[model samples]
Target: MMKVHNRPQNRCFFLFFHRNGQNIGFAMPVIFSSEDGKCFIMEFCIYPEFRGNGTGKECARALLHWAREHGALYAELNYGGDERRCHFWESVGFVENGSDAWGEPLMILPPTEDVPITVEILSDPEDWQLMKLENGFKREIGENALTGEKQKQLQQAVKQGKITFFIARRGYRAVGMCSAAKCYSTFSCWDTAVFEDFYIEPVFRGKGIARKLAKAAQTWCAENGMSSLTVCCAPCDENMYQSLGFDVRLGTTFAHLE
Candidate 1:
């Protein structure tokens, strides 16, 4: 099952990888979900002589590009949990997310376009917006932790401008969000912002929504003349924050949740 040698001819599209007029390899891709714009890589091969030396990587990128041109919003492939294979695919922008029905690990590369997703700083949000925010809190605090009182407090905070939420939406549905809260900084004698409550719906992740949310929050801070923007994140998430221009390392933070 690792490779489908006998793919259905009518459903598969074959592609050849070439350089300098010489064929290097071939790939077979199937448009599995036309409506959702999803493609599955049925098979791929590189001639034994041309297996390494960056040839495979180059071909993989080209194949994905071709998939996108064919109207695929996402590309998927199944691979085992081999470290080398994982590293190779991840290097080319594929993220190992879940497993197929057969338990084969599935990897995906999200859509290329970051548009059609609008990020806005909300001063007056509708009921759907409040529901989405509550959904984020439910995920973070676990089931039943989002009590009625807590929901009311969150809505009140947003209404009073005690917190600002940057909501990312796909059409009318809210897909992701991040919030910022301002605090007076005695040391700088100015107000500063701490970004928090970053959340994206699981299915909509890896499509650059997080970056959009972060950018919106950062821009709002600048426009409002806040002195600085900071986030307290776990060591594992340091790289994610740093990538979004939070490069200055402030000392580690310890919190008492109670």
Candidate 2:
């Protein structure tokens, strides 16, 4: 049996097996973010033959420890909305987000009305400005818990192809921004955060600036080959998202740890 080690910065893991090993297994760490700097797991898996050998649990624990060591405030995982995986995640202390594979209860925003707003993909040089605006947006939306380092990590994720950022403007001022990343399954959008600063500017409130921005985001996703979209919001903002044609998925859970 040959030994191989592959660990990428974006991925955290230790794989061991033969070059021609049958039923090869994997136990890797999955990382994601919340409104704050906390980390979460969108999914984790091992080969079927290796499931009952206690490898999964060990890997999960190791991953949790890694997250804690990295200063994550909390860790999360989403299981298939089935009896088996659901029970396993619960036993490991993960709660459901009342969402299933589609991550329903997910917010969906409607298309904008071809208004005067201009939307464009953000450039690298603009990251500093984007970060500044995003921080203000986070504060306004009560997501001020994110540390500057974590915010930088988020920006890095975007630059590394792990995420995408879009901005909407009306002349020289940026009115809104949307951050989205490819979902785990390769055909959907997940964790779409429409930053708060993007909300209708005081002078532009109630005129559907957000709707336009969101619509542009959807268009971008679809054009880029994403078949579905999903976004999560606080309970307080559910109505607004629902009004945009997003269906709320039930039975999933969401929690924050201090």
The most accurate candidate by lDDT is 1
Estimate candidate 1's alpha-carbon lDDT, on a 0 to 1 scale: 0.76
Quote each prediction's TM-score.
0.54, 0.45
Identify the leading candidate in terms of TM-score.
1
Writing each residue's lDDT as its tens digit, candidate 1 over 1-258 gives 323435543256878998889998999888654345667887878898888888889999899888778777777787676888778888898886544433355667755555488898875744455454555445444543345566678778888889998888865546677888999999789999999888776657778989999999999999999999999988888999999879999897887897
Q: Candidate 2 residues 1-258, lDDT tens each?
A: 112123333343443332245534544343323222235454466666666766666666666666667655455444434677766665666653322122221111112233376777777723554654565455455564346677668767777877677776654445467766665452333333222234433334566766777777678777877655566677887888777655655434577989
- Model 2 residue 72 distance off true place after TM-score fit, in angstroms: 45
Q: What ranges in model 2 sit over 4 Å off?
A: 1-115, 145-148, 186-200, 248-251, 255-258
